[model samples]
Target: MNIIDNFDTLHRAATRKAMQRLIPLMCAIYFMSFLDRTNVALAKAQLAIDVGISAAAYGLGSGIFFIGYALLEVPSNLAAHRIGPRRWIARIAVTWGILSTAMMLVQGEWSFYVLRVLLGIAEAGLFPALMYMVTLWFAPNDKPVVVGWIYIAPALALMLGSPLGGALMQMNGLGGLHGWQWMFMIEGIPSVLVGILLFFKMPERPRDARWLSAEEAQALESRAAADAQGHPELTSSDWMAALKRPTTVLMGLIYFLNQVAFVGLYFFAPSMIQQMHVKSPLLVGVLAASVGLGFLLGVLILPRIHRRYGNDCAFLGMLTVGLIAGACAFIATSSPAARMVLLAVTAFFAGGVLPSYWAIAMKRLHGIQAAAGLAFINTIGLIGGFVGPYLFGLAETVTGRSDSGFYIILVASLLGLLLVPLFAKAIRRETEASSPLGNGSAAGMQS
Candidate 1:
C-alpha cells in the first residue's frame, strides 16, 4: 500500500509539473492564432472604405479563411501524428504568421480573399495537434481542466486584442499605412517568434520532456498507454470509419450550429455596437472587449459546473441556456447599454460550452483517433465558420442594417438545442458498444 501510495504521489506531481510547464506555452500559441484569425473582424469598416469592398464581399473574404482551414485540417493533423506535433505546430505557426503579416499588402478584395485562404491553409492543424498532445502527456481525468486552460487563449486574445487592435488602428498615419494594415503587421509578428520558441521548447511526448524525471515520465507514459488500450489508433484504412461514427457526425453537427451562432455574433458584434451610434473606433473596441470578459468568465467558471453535474447534463444545459439567452438578447432590446450587457451574457454561456464539449469529445476518442477525429470534427464544423459570416454579411448587405443577421443566429441556436439529445444518445450507444461488458462505464471511458 505504501508503494502504491508513493507511485500515486509521484504521478500527481508529474501531472502538476506538466500542466505548469506546458499549458502556458500552449495558451500563448493559440492566443496568437485566434488574435490573427479574428482581428480582421475589427478591421471591417475601415478595410471596406479603403478598398471599396462591400459588406457581402468583406464577409465572404473573412469566412473564406475557414474553407482553406477545413480542407487541410485532417491532413495536417495526420502529418502532425506522423512527424511529431512539435515540428508540425511550429511550422504551422511560422507560415501562418508570415501570411498574416502579408495582409498589410492587401490592395483589393481579391488580395484579401487570397491571403485569408492561404493563412487558413497554414494554420490548419494547430488546434487538433495541440489536443493530440494532451492525449500524449495527460491522463483522461486531467483533460477537462487542462483543455480549459488551453482554451483561455482565445478569450484572452479577444479581451486584450480589442484594446490592442484599437490602439493599432490608431496608428493610421504612422508609416503610410492604414490603421488596419498596421494592426495586421503588428499582431502577426509574435506568432513567428512564438513558433521559433515552440520548436525549442515543446517536447514530442512525456518521455521526451526533460523537465520530468525518469520515474515521472514513466508514470505519465503508462497512464497514457492505459488510456489508449481498447481504443485503436486511427489508420488510413479506417480513418473514414472513425470520421463517420454516429457520435462523431452528431458532435460535428452540433459544433457546426454552435459555430454558426458563435461566429455570426463574434464577427458582427463590433459592427452592431457601432450601429448603436458610438462613433469612436477605440470605444467600439473597448465595448467589444466586454464579450471577451464574458467568455473568460465562462471558460473559467462554467467547467466547474460540468464537474458538478457531469458532462452531458452540463454541456446541454450550457448550450441551451446560452443559445436562448443570446437569441433573446438580440430580439428583446435595441437599447445600446442593455444590448451590450446581454451580448456579454450571451458570450458568457457560449464560451462555457466549448471546454465541456471538448472534454466529452476527448474522452470518447483516443490515440490517433483523438488526433484525426478531432480534426475531422473541427473541419466539418468550421464550415459553419464560413457559412455564418458569409450569410451574416449577405443579410446586412440586403437590409443595410447590421443587426439584420440576428435571424441566422436564432435559427442556428434552435437547431443546435434540438441536436443535443441526439448527441447524448449517440455517445451512450458508442460507449456501451465499446465496453467489454455491454455497459458503458468502462475504465477507459471513465472521466
Candidate 2:
C-alpha cells in the first residue's frame, strides 16, 4: 500500500496514546517554567519592600534570569542531545526544582539574582529539546497541531497563574513563609515529581516506542516517512552544519524580535493592570487570564487560516494588525477597559506565530539538526528575551512612565511584519530551486 493508504489503517488510539502521555508532561514543565519566571512579577507588587529590594532592583534581578538562559541555551541543548533527552530532561527538572526551593532564601537582590540565574540555566534546553522530540515522533501533517498544543502551555500558564499564583502567594500563613517563597516551592515540586513519572512513560522515538503495537508503529512511521520525504539522520557534525545555514540565521533574528515583544508583554502584564489603578492582585490576575484565553482561541484558529492563506500572508497579516492594536492600546491609557480589550487582541495575534513558526522550522530541519537548529534560533532569540524586560524597566525608570517603552515594542512588531515577506520569498525560492525544473539557476537557495 502507498503511504496514504497505510496511514488510513492507523489505530487512532495508538497515535493518540503517546500524545495523551506526552501532552501533560509537556504542559506541566512549560507551565512550571512560566510560573517560576513570572511568579516574581506577581510577588513584586507586594513583596519587593518586604524582601528588601527596590522595584528597579527587582527588575534587574528578573532580567538576569534570561541572561543566564541565553548564555546556556546552545550548550545545554547540545548536552541534551549528547547525553540523551530522557536523563537530560529529568536532570534539568530536578535541578530547577532545587533552584525553585532555593528562592525561599532570597533575603535581598543578590540572592534573588543567584536563584534566577540558576533557574535560567535549568530551563535553557527545555523548549528546543521538546521541539527535537516532536520531530522524532509526530508526522508533518500532525506536527503543527501537536506543536500548537504543546506550545499552548505558555498561554495556559498565564491563565492558571493569573489567579492561582496569587492565591498561592496569599497563603503566607503556613509556617510564616512569604507568598513569593510559596510561589516557588509549590510550583517547583511538581516538575520533579513529573520528571520521575516521565521516565516510566516517554519513549525515545516512535520506532522504539513500546506503547505502540508493531502495526501501529509501521503506520505512524509510514506517514512520517512520506511526509518527510525519507528521514534524514544527523550526526554531531550535522548539528554544526545546520546552525551555519543562512536561513537558520535569518529565522534566529526573527525569533529574537518576536520574543522581545512576547516576554516583555508577559513580564509586565500584571504590573500594567496594577498601574491602571486596579489595586487587587486577584483582579489583575483575572485580566491577565483573559489575555491567555484569547491566546488559546487564536491557536485553535490559526492552523485553518494558514491552510487557506499560506504561512507568510497569515503571519504578516496578523502581526501587522496586532502591532497597530497593541500601540493603540498603550497610547489610549485613558480607558482601562478599552486597553484590556486591545491587549487581548494583541495577545491573540501574537500567540498564532509560535506554532506556525515551529512548523516552519521543522520543515527546514530534520533529525538531530532540529534540536541544535532550534537551540541556536532560541539562543539568539533569548538575547531579546533578556533585553525585553530590562528595556521596559529602564524606560520606566528614566521616563517615570511605563507606557513610553511600549512604543519601542510597537516599532519592533512592525519591523517583524517586514521580515515575514522576506521569509516567504525565501521559502518559495527554496521550494522552486529544490524542484526538478529549476536546477542550478537558483543556486543561492542551497542552505
Candidate 3:
C-alpha cells in the first residue's frame, strides 16, 4: 500500500483496539455518574411530596452539588494526577455512590442539600481526570472523538435514567421505601460496583494497558511523545505552571458559559416537559429523555463538522445552532408538541459545546498539564452548573411558570455564542503559535 493508505490502516487498527478497551467501560462509568446526578430531575415530583421540597428548595438541593464540586475540583484532580486513576477514580465513584444511596434518607431541605453537596465533593474529579486520562491513551486528534464517546454516558443516563427513575417511583411503599427513595437506592448500586471494577481493571496509562499488543502499545507511546514535543507547555508536570497559563483561564471561562447554557436546560428538563400537559411522570421522563436524541446527534456529528469546517467555523456552527434553537424554544408555547422538538434542537447544540470546546483545548493541552488545565476550567465552569439550575429555579419561582426558565437558558446560550469567538481566536493564536510555520510560544499570551 502507498503511505497514505498504510497510515489510514494503522490509524484505524489502533483506534479500534484502544477504543474497544476504553469506550465501553469509560462510557459505563460516565453513564453511572451522570445517571446519579440527573435522576434527581426525574424524581422531582415524588421527592416534592415525600420531603416537602418546594421548587426553590429542590433547585437548591440540585444546584448545591456543584458548589461542592467546584470547591474540591482542583484538589481532586491534582490528587488524581498524583495518586493515579485506579485508586482515585475508585474512591470517587464509591464515595459518591454511597452518598447517592444515602439520599434515600433525606427528610427535609437541609438533609437533601447536605447530601447533594457531599455527592458533589465525592464526584468532583471524574470529568477532568478522565479527560487527562484520555490524553494518556489517545492522540491529540483522537481526544475529541474519545471524549465524545464517553459523552454517550450522559445521553444514556438521560434516556434510560429518566424512565428508570419514573418506574422506580412507581414502587413506592414497596419494602417500606418511597419510590423516590427506591430510585436513589437502586441506581446508586451500579456505581459502587463500577468503582470496585475500576480498582481492579483501570489502567493508569497506555504503558499499563495489558489489553494492548506490544505494537499497539508502542504506537500509543510514540503518539504521546510526538504530542509532548509539539506542545512542550502542555507536557509540563508543574500544575502551577499550567495554572499560570492564560489559555487555562480563558478555557475555564468558555467552559463556564457552556455549562451555564446547557445545565440550565438539563436540570430542568423533566419539569419543562411536564408543563406541556404531560401528567404521567413516566411519560414526562420519556419525553425529557428525548434530549438524549439531540445529544447523540451532537456527539456523532461534531467530529465530521470540525474536519470539514475547521475549529472556528465548527464552533460557530455549534453555538449558532444553540442560539437559534434556544431562542425558538424560549418563544415556543407550552402546549405545542413542537416545543419539545425545539427544546431538543436546543439540547443538540448545548450538548455539543463541551466536546467541541474540550476538543479544541485538548489540541493545545496534554499530560498532567492537561489534567490541571481541565480541572481549572471545569472547576470554574461547574460554578455555572450551580448558577444555571439555581437561577433557572429562582426565575421559575418568581414567574410562576416552569417555562419561564427557557428564557434564562436562551440568555446563557447567547452569551456563550458571543464569547465563543474570542475563545476560538485564542485557540487559533495558540494553534498558529504551536504550528511549525509560526513563531510558537505562549509566553506573551499569559495574563
**Number of the top-ranking candidate, with TM-score as the measure:** 1
Which lDDT tens digits does candidate 1 get at residues 81-165?
8999999999999999999999989889999999999999999999989988988888767777888888789999888898789
Q: In candidate 2, which residue pairs clash?
A: none
For residues 279-319, what per-residue lDDT tens digits would candidate 2 score against the true structure? 87677778878667767766777755654544444555565
What is the number of backbone collisions in each predicted candidate, taken in the order shown? 0, 0, 0
Which scores greater on TM-score, model 2 or model 3? 3
Model 1 regions lying over 4 Å from their true place: 228-238, 311-314, 439-447
What lDDT would candidate 2 get against the real structure? 0.72
Show model 3 residue runs off by greater than 4 Å: 1-11, 232-237, 431-447
RMSD (Cα, Å) for all candidates, in order, is 2.1, 3.0, 3.2
Give the better candidate number (2 or 3) by lDDT. Answer: 3
Question: Where does candidate 3 clash, by residue pair?
Answer: none
Candidates ranked by lDDT:
1, 3, 2
TM-score of 2: 0.91
* Alpha carbon lDDT of each predicted model: 0.84, 0.72, 0.77
List the candidates' TM-scores in order. Answer: 0.95, 0.91, 0.92
lDDT of 3 by residue, 1-447 (tens): 897677566656876788887788788788899999988898777778877898888888888899999998888888987889768888989999999999899999999999999999999999888887777777766777888888878987877888888888788899898888998999998899998897888788776787776666767766754453364434444767767766677777767866776787788888888777789877887788778777877777865565445444345545666555765655765546777777777777778656766766666566677778788888889998988888878988898777777777777767766665566556557656656778644432321
By summed lDDT, which 10 consecutive residues of candidate 2 come out lowest? 438-447
